[model samples]
Target: MAREPLHLLKTVYGYDAFRGRQAEIIDHAIAGGNAFVLMPTGGGKSLCYQIPALCRPGMGLVVSPLIALMADQVAALRQAGVKAAALNSSLAPQERTAIWQAMEKGALDLLYVAPETLLRPAFLERLRAMRLSLIAIDEAHCLSQWGHDFRPEYRRLDCLADLFPDTPRMALTATADAPTRAEIVSHLKIGVENSFIAGFDRPNIRYAIAEKDAPRRQMLAFLEAHKGDSGIIYCLSKRKTEETAAFLNERGYTALAYHAGLDKAVRDANQTRFQREDGLVMVATIAFGMGIDKPDVRFVLHLDLPGSIEAYYQETGRAGRDGLPADALMLYGYEDIALRQRFIDESDAPEQRKRMERQKLDALLGLTETGQCRRQVLLNYFGESHAPCGNCDNCATPPEMFDGSIAAQKALSCIYRTGERFGQAYIVSVLLGAEDERISRFGHDRLSTYGIGKEHDARTWRSILRQLVAHGLVNVDLAGHGGLSISERGRDFLREKPALMLRIPARTGGRPAKAAPHEVARGIAPADRALFEALREKRLSIARAQNLPPYVIFHDKTLVEMAVVRPRDRRALEAISGVGHSKLERYGAAFLDVIARHSP
Candidate 1:
């Protein structure tokens, strides 16, 4: 087989070429090899399977966890003229029978089924009778018990590959750390030589961690800055999701709440609206959705802490899938840690499971408290080394560190004076020498350290408390009565390193400038703006007709470039960033016609 043929197929699909390790994985799969692909979201994982499905004979078997993902992917493939169909509980009996018939008749090139459907003995027997070109396990991390979203059904999928030893198999996921990766391989019985790990850096997403202050007020500021843009606000609880969505809706924004509590129809409808419409926000919890294929989410706001960094990364990965600039904002506080610990303690998981969950939780908390570049920390979590991105909040506004040895001593003294039985709010009150009923009842008013730190406000005292927790100088006893207690690190800090550097929280207040108009000519004359829109519309229409992603047809940046250069012919279009000789040959006439019609 000639490699040039794949390149020609690439051009026909309007993509420049395979991205990252896509071509390598595709080749391996096409040659009847097994692969375990650990690629992040927006890392071109789909191409690894999609290209092989297109190049090889027989239908590709895609086992997905979500029905919505199946539908979205099938729709995208169909739009590109690929004969794809999904068989899941959502399909009618007749429709399901027809799809299976189509599969047996070899009319469908790709078939997506839920894991439950794949586990059926009859279904497996039918699949055995068909010619399966390859098996692609999407969201492969779910196979591991250590994974945050462990599904029992995923573990059974290994039998599918077992029954079809001659077929190639590929497993892909957006988030998996070292242990999770190892567990996936062992659970699926995959060989190490077959795994392909793509670099897990999403450079386009700017990461920021905001100290939990008035969370609602902080969220408002963030939304105000990035108004009229699509985003997702993830809350830890369903009530919070409803409240946040309602609050945003009341504030004159298009916001919808989605959780498992709602009817399935409503959830599907809201998700569809969010993906198809512009500037719509979906406030959801972990129960709502995953593997959403929306490409233009501009931001992901975490109103509460996620249980693990993996969950956080995957949720935030939803933003900027189009490889454009976006934001990841996390609002965290001490209470979040307690909430997670409490939830973990109540779960029916085994001791090992609980231990792994705690470790994951600690990793998430470490990201919140670290003064290092947020992006670097996130990348490092996924086994990638990177210097400071110089784009996150920590890199942009470096914190001012102060020697808080004496302050740490004072705060520790207060906690001791109160018998280590108080939460953060009460501790702050005592540190500030506020006379409250709780303090009076506890006789904390007579302590020597009382009123010692009266000069600092409640905010300053709260910052000290947070730093104490972050440094492991103090620990919140989740199993006990939920109060702060001094740790051994605290004693060491007091005795050995008297001078500790503590970071001051970034101040929050300001109205960001409104986004410039979507029109290309922000400050240009109306005639030029009209011409730009005309050109863009023409490009989009051509993209649709050719069954390609809009950006592959001509990136938004390329359209902006065309607007500036007023490219008049094939030669000029070929000089554009994304348009090469093949693109110019195929698409030049249509774009040039638009420019000719619109040019003054």
Candidate 2:
């Protein structure tokens, strides 16, 4: 029996084979099937439709939410020697007309358009005349009301699928939970049988959450420890994004800020720079990740807690696309929980929506506070099970926990002495037997347990309080509200002599040597280092000339492989991973000439 067309396309796309359910999804789409594809960010979701798009008889219609994604995908396909074009708001009238003409003349094999444009009667009429092999909906999670980036326009997508009922439709998103999956199916009218949920595990991404204290300093320390590596710092607000970016820039790092507040051109330029420039760090809000295609990001640090675990998973999933090791570091604080709760309380959403939002927030909090393996906690939330990932901070730098029974008793006694109505500050002051105005005002200095915890520093006591709350021994009474209160566990502890152990928070200030830089430089020959730089420059130039992502032209791995193999001809070049027939035909000569010129 002959090999499937998808297998051939996989070979042509420079992949040794399809991963997970890619083959099944691609085969289904090629057979004119409708599919709801829920694959993680690093998963090969694009190949599901790209392969089928190539095998089908006519142009593939890729409905994307962002103009950047459309342009990037079209550029990538064209670079792979597949005829492709994009029609979006950013294109000039002439460009749109040329694309329309190309479509009518069958000069393009793939056409990417924005959902808004697809809804326009004129564009739909024009599309009706062309034969559409497939309709791919990128970021399909946006169709769900429960999704973080829900766009009202996505609901209109069902009309296009109806209009092109005969064409196969594939809705692709990097992250979607069960509810979002149902929404995609219903909103897009996709059949249940065609739904494909790829495994959500991104094993290459190690997850860690640190309790927030001196976050800016922690961020700087993290950046210093991973210097010259590609990463993203996610903030909850535009101001934080700008401030963080500026701070990183001042520290001599290649950092940029991206948020909706920036002008369109500035955002585009920053994104382009980040993608093309090696080791550039992008500090951005949730608005940033939808269309980003960079593959070598070494880490994703969240300065604030994300609204939901789904959002966090999707955002962090952007790292380590090459299946290399990556880090997902998050800083959580009491303020983050309050901020999320406030948002949920103030929103005009229905009761059910608000409830769901709270559940999601709790899940994120659970992730932040859990002492178990970070990977296990994350995977368990997603209905998957895994053994402890021994790579995260919790596992590698296990906290030194001591019996905190005496400290807990003293802290609780202080809270009781202060009437259980004050915040941590008052409690801390009472525990230290401070004669400050607040302690005097509350008359907490005279308590029996006062001065008992004076041996520990104020910071140490605060750490214990945070850990206590995390361990469910205590709770913050949001109803009381925002004051410390003992939970049932705390009462039980007080009655039965509960034992406690707490991790001393790691101090953050000075920089440590960044993770082994030599690991990245390992395979490169000393002689070919300059040659590698030249190849990268050449690749960048081609990328710029065609307005495509640099990686689409040639990934870093491909360049490294080229340097190692020093292929002299197309046959030799074809043997390198990520260099398929299409890529070799398009880029082989230029690289070969470079290698030949540089050869001894």
Candidate 3:
């Protein structure tokens, strides 16, 4: 095999070693083999194809969907002194001409284009005439109808097999379950034997989920620990994104709103600022964050429930891409579930697609209400078994499990006695013997199940009922007004009186202190914090001057390492993880100067 990949890895990217399966994947690509790669986000999937592209004899072609992602990757690649350019609608005519001329002369090592650009007959003919190194399809899951983010344009990508029959191709994605994987293989016409299934686990991210109680207050409490950190907050609606962004800004935080409803220029400007600035929180809907390559996102907070486990995983995976400690906090409630279910029920999709969506939503609910390690349940959904990770909220603070069998029996009985026509609020009220007009009209107050749940408070009952829905003991009627009905399993529980363990909801009140035990922060030492901040200011200054994202210059992890190590000169600084020959030559002295000034 060739030794150039390793040499390039050290000299160009400054990493001393190849990560898991990276060497094998790169070797396979260099040997002209096609494959499907199932690596998680931040798993260095790019290097698997990038290294081989450089080692091969011709220019590499990357097919991407997002213009911003293409621009970001090209900028980063050029920062490393590699010949990279992007051909997208955003480029000027002269710029496009320059890129085309460069491609024709083999002056560019890699060229990124939208799938539409690559599929154009003229562009395809030009590419056919060139000596192609390799073709890499990023976010390949979009090609699968079973995938969460399906685009019709991606379906046409299968034609690449006929167009470039001799070029090695690799389809890569971070979020794909078994069915999605099978669909990708069938759609791309790649062999299943060539698949590399890197296990889906982001240990650096701490997973936390709470039932929505005073959501804005809870969001504030969570943000307290992450002051001045870059993060994203996902909402379910455009109005909520605007309101939340305004709310956070009023509270003295730098926040921005993004949605498809906004003007294209305004949306692009907000996204550009979020990318170029540091410590800005972006509140947006699902329209944002598909191909965002920001690495230092300290947290990802979801104010509303995502549609499925795959959507949740893909969104939360945006955080901690630098492999540093980060947090993923999601606050969901019964209303969120009802809203999501109604969306699925109202969609124009076929019955089979709707059924698949229901199952996916059920899987998400199972994750939210599970008493086991949240990571374990999430991985299990993706067909991987993992031991309980101690990093999630459940593992960090084990919930108080009580025998909820009596509570379950009472709830099931109340739903049945009340004719299963009311939602959680009405059912809880009936169980608590509330004197409401609806209850009096229905004469539920006279039922045997009435007043039987007076021992537990309203909050406790709501928790129990929600868990029942999650456990499949209850079903919500999306076609109706979210009426609750007992499932067969719930009836069996009433007859057999099976023991059920349920978690007591945690108490919420008051603002938390600055640093909570579970809150993950940069692992910088107290003594080195000053130097770290100084280095960050320096990096940000340089980035602003160059109009590039701070991460493209150097990731936060590299800064933390530099702060701790206090690299004093060129040689010592070059030993840092991200300091390659190009960066060391261009940026080494400036960073060294900052470190020297902080010295005692």
Winning model by TM-score: 3
TM-score to native of every candidate shown = 0.87, 0.89, 0.95
Give per-residue lDDT, candidate 1, residue 464: 80
> Which candidate leads the pack in lDDT?
3
What lDDT score is found at residue 471 in candidate 2?
Answer: 57
lDDT computed for candidate 3:
0.88
lDDT tens string, model 3, 1-600?
A: 234999989888889999999999999999999989999999999998889999999999999989999989998888888899999988899999999999999999999999988888998988899998999999998887766789888999999888898999999999999999988877787888889898799998989888876789889988988888889999999999999999999999999999999999999999999898888999999999998999988899999999999999999999989998788999887778877878988899999999999899999998898889999999999999999999888887777788999999999989998898899999999889898998898888899988899999898899888788777788788678889998887888788998988878876432212224332224666788899889989999999999999989998888888989999889889889988899998899999999999988
How far residue 412's Cα lies from its native spot in candidate 1, in Å, is 2.3
| Range of the 10 consecutive residues with the lowest summed lDDT in candidate 1 | 509-518
Candidates arranged by lDDT, highest first:
3, 2, 1
Model 3 misplacement above 4 A: 1-3, 435-438, 477-482, 487-499, 509-521
* Model with the higher lDDT, candidate 1 or 3: 3
How many residue pairs collide in each prediction?
Answer: 0, 0, 0
